[model samples]
Target chain A: MLTSNRRLVVYGIAGALAIGSGAAFAQGAVAAQYRWLTFAVFAAIICVTMYVTYLAAKRVKSASDFYTAGGGVSGLQNGWAIAGDYLSAASFLGIAGLISQYGYDGFMYSVGWLVAYITVLLVIAEPCRNIGKYTLPDILAYRNNPKAMRIVGAISVVTVSTFYLTAQMVGGGVLVKTLIGIDYEISVMAVGVLMLAYVLFGGMVATTWVQIIKAVLLVIASLVLVMLVWTPYGFSLPAFLADVVGDTKVQAKVAGLLGDAAKNMTPQELGQRFLEPGLYFKAPIDQISLGMALVFGTAGLPHILMRFFTVPTAQQARKSVVWAMAIIGGFYVLTLFLGFGAAKEVGPGVIASIDAGGNMAGPLLAQHLGGGPDSFLGNFMLAFVSAVAFATIVAVVAGLVLASASAIAHDLYVGVYHGGDIVPPQQQVRAARIATVIVGAVSISIGIAAKGQNVAHLVALAFAVAASANFPCVLLTMYWRRCNTGGIVLGMVVGTVAAVGLTLVSPNLTYPKAVRAASQKVLDGEAAKRSAIEAALASGDAAAIEKATVDQKALDKAVTKAKDDMKKVEGKEVSIMGLEEPLFKLKNPGIISIPLGFLAVLLGALLFRDKRSEELWPEVYARQNTGILASKATSH
Target chain B: MATAPKIDWNAVIADPRFQALHRRKQGFLTGLMIFSVVFYFLLPIGAAYFQDLFKTKVWGVVNFGILFALLQFVVAWGVAIYYSRVANRDFDRMAREIAADYEKGG
Candidate 1:
């Protein structure tokens, strides 16, 4: 390992060089009034995290140290880190926006996310800690053909991480651009470089600390907003919720968003509708499908699973998960108040007008709570929240980079290429740092290329693949005695193919141009009819005028019907085949792909018998349960 | 880089204490796993089929659905805290003893 002093000098020079170049490149004149405050907050966050990374860099000595902080992370610390790693900008902002706009459905949407940890806590966390070492493939390759298992494991981890990373990168850039007027490409590069620095120098220690800091900041920021919103109702949740569902102003504002759909409903009816489930999701199956994905998919996410290895023992792993559950569960619960609070105070129409997706609801609510945007307090709160959001995205992306890098360097480079035998630890750590750079570069490129595209579906796609592909194999490898190397490979391949294939043919792929043309046709036809009616009325003959009045009434009704149809079609997606409707109806593939994955594993095990794998079952079982031969904490 | 010491894993697996610890942990985990899974899925199922039932107000503006959904967070924390306690109290003790047996014998 490099001496701490030498490493410090190298990192200092690199940091100085980066700061100089970043200042030169980010000199674009941003128009926001509070741009200076935002930049200051951003700089402060970076400096603190980099300092933490510098300290962590001194401790990273071996491959294990680089990957798992030498297994020295306490249960509480790792628990907070997992929360930091798990709650991306999506959960913090996206879910809040959903609830703010969609009402009760949005709150319901968050329940599954919290409950997902039950899977992680009950089924996966302790066993994962007892079984795996550096990467997830460690568990799979233990009793099987190590080479094939490692190769497949690396591929799956990289694939899942890449999808997840792209979403975060794009979201980070877009969020920064919207909040502080930074250029999207520049912001993406900045996020990539900062994440690379964390993993390259600090490794898991830096990444974990970064996550902990971000998670704490995020919760504090959210708590502030929730408290501000609830203060009006004397901090009573029931009173706040009562106003959300009973207030005439809130009901009217939300009902107006539904347009003609709520025309006949009374204010009380609309208030009740606001707290009902069907307001956002027309189909219940979509909710159920997404729920399945979140609940199962969380257990299989490589980044989340990697957290367990940071703890010393299975019991610590279990305790860390419990801590994570409390924090995560509490955060999701707070989202209920935040979402409804925004709807109550900021108004859904106002939130939607700012960002159609409501991604800015949290920040916007912060601004509204402080005052209006014109006030200094409002702008300051906005800047603070925007900074926290930036930290959130960076922390998540850093974790993603570490996960993919470990999979590549630990599983593929060391395990597969070197046959898990003679690779030196320092060289392995070097390979991991190199892998981090490559993963960061690739994700940055993908994020830039995918700029301005609707990438919301990629998040769902990532979860679905994790749930279907990785989860089944990992679950079976531990629980099923008959599961073998052939079974794992087949299960991963089949599950990945099924999930991706279903998404490809599903309504996720839509012909926007054609939909626009169809809507234009309706508008144009209506315009022609309107001119004809005008001409008839202008002729000033009593008979023709009377006839024109009747036709005008009919035309008005038809126009309203046509406009509503167009509105519905605008949100609905079509398959890439140019079909008006998708062959596959469900947006998420978890309900279908998960079972197919399990079935494929069964089929593969029955077809290809591996005596060696069968013979190792006792050892694997004993170790996974009792932690007899499981990898121990690395020595300094 | 020390390799793990070799021991008779089959014998360890056959040890009565090891077997009992495994059995109890698995039984408890399986039961909790089933309960949590079933309890969790009820959210979507209730939302999908029994909309009115879920909408029945329990308190001021807090409907059965919202209450039920919020209850999930409690249940999750309860499951996690409860499981961790049982695992530490009953399971971890037994596992340490079994591991100690092997450490000495090997």
Candidate 2:
């Protein structure tokens, strides 16, 4: 099916990945025990999900089924799916980890995510369901030049989804390595292959079910953790909170972790300070920027938006948003308890020692709550939570892949390249499958290559892009009367460029790094000297070998020092633009970029006047509001 | 799918019921959106500016800041529930009638 050149490219990529991961595999370390328990849980999960996939595969007959599950998903089911898709490993692991380390400051980071859903329920959800079909671009292409709108929309979807997918993939791999004993490369490969199976075979139907299952599991697990955490305090909320802030043991734990940073503060001061804000977000503006991104960006996330299309009516869509808000809001509330519980029970020092970013806080707490690491209950709980986290990654990534696949296949390949013609449904489904494979392969390769790198910022970057690029166009096209094809295109281009451009120059990227050229020169020269000494020491001449051995020890010490010096200077020596710091101090660009997006949409519409767009405005508005002439749910 | 009835766009927009629906819905949505945005931003702003006030303990380990933050969840849910009820009661009925009238006219 593939051309020789394409096959060669695929083979070349595969070969590079093999060789790259092979090198890292040699040094791979596994942190937790009871590998068999993790494997057993993982096997059970895969079997159940794959069986659901098999059932879904039989029902997927046309492009509509592949894209929107034939528009048959119930409101409650779709809401669960949305919750599952939106709450990735980041929400479950990352937020808990942050809260466990930073206390109240970490809890502040989570509040915005739940409130953002109100924006979706009020402004975006129903209109999107009424106007869209199969993909997000359908809303734009409804009243604009189909080719231009679909193409641009497809690009935006791919860009946001790719950034998000990479983060999930890398997180999944690292967590598997820590939770189970699997090598990172093998875990990444396994996750990628499993995701491909779901998207390529079962399409949206299976993705939705996987998400529902994962959401239920994640929620139940969090609830259990929360209950177990508070039970020690006699299930009293006030008592728990009091203990969190007043317990001498907790204060000692915090003081020990703070070490030199504790200053002259006593246990009481540290305990009281732990319940205040300003620990994680030292800069007020940074918190505002992050808030802006979470609030606005969630409404624009392509995968989350795509879920709206799976249900039939705008009413159902509206109901789903309410359901999602409750479920997601409850889950986020649970994180507060989980984080503080982990802080008190597991201790920040132990948490940081495991993963440094506190990613292991939730699972580690589970182990502690089940009776310490040496107990069987502890091992079982850890394995169960870790497996749930793994499932969370798979469900989220599958949703992303499906969204981008629809963007590529339904929006660009069929909508644009086919000149907006009605392609055969089977052909469209086939195209979507092909797109799934391409998207999966590309994200997997990037994920493997980005191993062990700090990817927490990628999630924020995705949200910023979605907020800046996609949200503006969707809002303007639906609501603005004079919004033309030119306006939509220009808005997308300008918004994307502005958001990405600002990020490039923001502190997110412009932080210091050691001069690569100088560092590499010293390292390469030292490596050569060490090799020379190693060669001489390998010979049988005792005196020469003894002298070479001394030289080898000196070379080794020099290399170690050189590496340490490089690490120390990484964020101290220089920045990309040869400046001490970036001009843009805000880490997340949403506060500025979101407004710039709206301005671009306004300017583009005013500048590029199109009579046809204005003429069609009434019909588009009526359909958006009243849902007349909207696509019906496809009957099986 | 049945062929869609041809309708006058300007006339529809000019219709009293349609205008009322649009006016009421927009007024509600715009006001709520503004209030929510401002209310949402108050978190970071209040936390930044009112540090001493926010740090005042209310109960055992509870402080003004944590209570305020937690109240956001309640506020968000309140807004959603209230809006959905209003939309279902008034907006949906008005929109439906407008659609039925248009169908008859066309």
Candidate 3:
């Protein structure tokens, strides 16, 4: 009875928040481009990973092996897996796509994932390793009231997992659809089946190896990209950047993001402005919201926290973070080169020609740098990158499924449902396999349903949930003795509700403006004239198509009329569920939800005042502090 | 009957070696975090308010924001490397010494 309320309230709020953004993206703008070579390369990568799964499955025996790879993974190896799981397609493609299109705003996206490791290093990882054997719930249950702790922990884990998994799947499906001519539904399900097979059979052991392989391939890809981008300019970054300064073409290309204000500026001034601040984060609140979410959210992600348990000891867990930071930091530096190089070399016009959404910025940049479209270099590089991207998505999804499945089997089924420690390891492992399939199926459905949504935005919402629901509970448990079971439970619920609630009402998730149809523009003879030009292009001089221009007065009048209507509706206070205008002004909910998460923890601890939480504190504290529990270490 | 581990958290906290380890980890982390937070905020805050300052070129063709953003990666790597060194030489050694002391009932 207590458990059901936790799951219902948390998932309910999160589900509602996701629906609005998912619906807005349903009208995806990117056209699918089928490349058979990309398909063959993708198939080869799949074959290798499936073979790895077979090897891992042969060794799997117990639940301990299922969740943590028997705690035998070395520091650097676990570090590689962490990097693999952490750097999803969002980092590889989304960052490049965004950077090539948006410039400085795009590079800021990668900084968070890099800086997030600091939080993981100094704060969460060691204590997590010391206390939790398998799931986030294990740490939460270390103190008072295992039932209460398990309920909220399970809820928080599943909520984070589902949102994060849906994001990876969405990116996987859409990018695959765009690169190869596969349908989005088929691509999503293909990813789902691969993820399910890995977790259900290979479990954590195979998942770790797959992550390590993907991470290595991705880093190598990033390095090669940096070299390719620089090779055109005699490998001199300064020469390339300076060369971009006076180019009227590159300046005009970035003009849309710079706004109409830049139209009067000289080309040099325009170039300088692109490198200056405020391309993306123009507001102080938006910047802070982004920072808070990235830093706190990374600390709270269930898969990342679970990675610490794979290492033998707390010390190695700490070392793994440093390794992740090194890889991530270097990767972001290379991304800077890619983003600026794409701006100077590929240009926005070329980027738009490939994909309107800029999702192809990285892959297309690789192809362009290799050679023009018709060349073997271009075609081959594109296929190679597509394979790496598909691998990136698979590794991320496998991790998500594993994390979510553990939350279900280890936390919910064994810890809560079957009663803790009474259920055998054998039974729990089987339950986890079942849970993986169910989670995989649901994620695939959401991915297909949410196809065309912006990858970075979907991911930011997931971070907001993690920052709000998970960070506070985990931090308080590590530091504060006063933190009660009720405190964490209340914190998780409040944080989830607040983050989801604020996100739903945020301006970022607003329904895109309705297009005033072209049928209405026929009154000015514009549509008729355009059709005439199109007909001429088919039978007459192709250059004659250049004579087509819409009647400016009629178009301007339509634009003004639409703007006035939106202007009037902008500040109007509507009901909570109304979609016409957002209730919250900020694009991100982190600035509000993070503090609320902490507030709920404080309030609940003070209000509920469970003596049991206080009593068990020293024992949990002792273990966490010195790494000793019940006459021995917990695990490696 | 299974025997529980004999533990004394108060003694551990009081141990000089433990205190040194704690002090080192906490101090380095606190300084690093503050430096990171302040340094990170400077990019955005400068970008938001002092746009003109970041627009000025310090080296070659790169503007101030570019240098500042690039420096973020360097500082992150430097801090991590520094932490790792301190952990291997000082903190880990202290941890082992404290554990040995507790085991010997010293």
Candidate 4:
């Protein structure tokens, strides 16, 4: 009777939330077509995912089984799952949008991401699997002070996970709103509930299989879509280029888009920008930076790394990574076509009209080429794509929650509470599930708060955090024996602060008004006046234009003052010399903050090296041997 | 002088079955790794560069390359499983052989 009462309460709450969500959906002016499919797909995916989780739970008999899938998952399966996890909506949608806007510079993301895996395979992969029990803190604490490592690891996990979770939630909302006529908040809540259910019930086993299925589907769908695109265009690279070059509007847009990239360009460079077909080959440095963030960030991601641990043996790890690389690489190549095809077929005007956020290009393409939104194929594709996007968010969120749960359960709670004595497997698993619900709730709150923010941009902030705080400590601990807990902790703190602090203050985070105001004061006074004049001209109010010119000198002076203030705040030279200077100086500093994190770790290690044991050799040797052996076995 | 604690030499190397199993596992994993490398790096580059010869548009060639890459991934997975089974068998055999040799004390 008590159990039934509890069940009733649970169902009642769920029913209320669903009802509320439906009301919100109706009020938000969502298209009915988008709503039905999204709801159906969301329900279907959640059900299937939960069933998979149930199977995993049934199989769980030990801590090892729950935490690492008993290290028995095949390498190939783990690899696909890893790729699935790594290739988020941000990568698929965001990169495509970036390419549509930026051109060749966009491919830099592909290079950065692919090459970072090389570093992972060589340096981090085997060692991480061998030494770390669950979370990164496990490995760090193994050699140093547990108390400090736990605190730092928790901070790192929470910080990265928070940003990642928020971005994914935003993505989920966008997916719902875009595909299934629903309110953004309701979509976010729906995704949150679905993810919470999966993590709480199924755990890592469900997470892995879900990721694998999604990865396969994403790859296959992309391939088919790319073929559809080429069939119309005749598949000739040079011919495609010629057609693109022939479009004067495209050339003008490309030139406009390149902005600063054109400043120091040779004729050939300028010509190439106008001539390029897909913007896969030529773009500006900022675009390059964005790409680097995507690519290099992949290796440093905690969620992706955790997937490797689920597979048994170093050999399996190796196999999984190889498979992941193949799938991910192939998927990226297909995205190029998708991006270009969208540009060709849907046209940029439609994209600009749908959402200025630029993340809707791929779905919009599916709608146009497959058939309009009302067509069977089109609606199905829309639902499928949106579902995939939602699935991507759920899969990533599950990984984040799991990582946080592990950090709490394995590192903090177990390490502190049990003093390394093995906790009962069932108890530990229960603790992890509880942790998942807690994390899920917190993430949902954050997602609701960060309404309407660009999901991709938010994800980049997570990457910046990961690159700054976690990457440094992980790398130093693995390679440098001199690194002590104090150094690792301090370095992580410093890195996290620098990256997060800078990101918060940067133009990306600040409101557009603040950015414009800040920029005006930093540049020259005359330039500021010129901008005001231009604004007046654009508005085409002759009376306002004449009046604006009378105070133009004053406005110019204010602009200069603003520019100077911005320069002072930014700690870089601001010149009226060109618009590019302020933007470049402003942008580079944020990204540059990431490397400072690496330096902090190095400094910390150097300073604290003597305090640690002289014979750190034994532990280091053990870890290295295990890593190498695992790698060799997996690589075989 | 006291001999170094009698090393378990017989226990270390006596199991031919274990070696065979280990070798099979190694072979399988190695094959998979090779496939992954080719699929990810070599094939994409080849297709991109030689799209004209493939008689497909560049994009089509790239798509084909991806298909091949997916295939390679499957192959790599198969090899990994084969390797794990063989390697575990070999390790077991080797351990048994070593124990037997130690017991015989030849």
lDDT of each: 0.82, 0.82, 0.74, 0.61
Give the per-residue lDDT of model 2 (tens digit) for A1-636. 224323433343344335323433322112334656765776677778877877787777789899999899999999999999999988899899998888887788888898888889888998998888888888888888788889899999999999999999998888877776567887787788778877878899989999999999999999999999987888876688877777554575456446578889976788877788777787898889888888889988999999999998888898899999999989988999999899888777667656768898999999898888788888788888988988999899999999999999999889878987878978998999999999999988988999977788899999998888889889889988889888888888888888888887777753444344555666888866777677888787886585565456545655665676577566465565666667787889988898888888888888987776787888888878877655433444
Fraction of true A-B contacts recovered by candidate 3: 0.40
Q: Evaluate residue A156 in candidate 4 and report its C-alpha lDDT on the 0 to 100 scale.
A: 85
Return the clash pairs for model 3, or none: A312-A636, A313-A636
In candidate 4, what are the lDDT values of residues A210-236, reduced to their tens digit? Answer: 788778777877877788877656876
Comparison by DockQ, 2 against 3, better one: 2
Per-residue lDDT of B41 in model 3: 65
TM-score-best of 1 and 4 = 1
Deviation in Å, model 1, residue A247 alpha carbon: 4.6
State the C-alpha RMSD over the true interface residues for candidate 3, after superposing those residues.
2.6
TM-score of each: 0.90, 0.88, 0.86, 0.72
Question: Which structure among the candidates has the greatest lDDT?
Answer: 1
TM-score of 3: 0.86
| Angstrom error at residue B8, model 1 | 1.2
Docking class of 4: incorrect
lDDT of 3 at B13: 71
**If you assessed candidate 3 against the hidden native complex, which CAPRI class would it receive?**
medium
User: Deviation in angstroms for A468 in model 4?
Assistant: 2.5
Superposed model 1: Cα runs more than 4 Å off: A1-31, A246-249, A512-514, A517-581, A631-636, B1-3
User: Candidate 1 vs candidate 4: which has greater DockQ?
Assistant: 1
Cα lDDT tens digits, model 3, A317-395, are 8788888888778877888787777776777556655565577777777777778576777777777788788888989
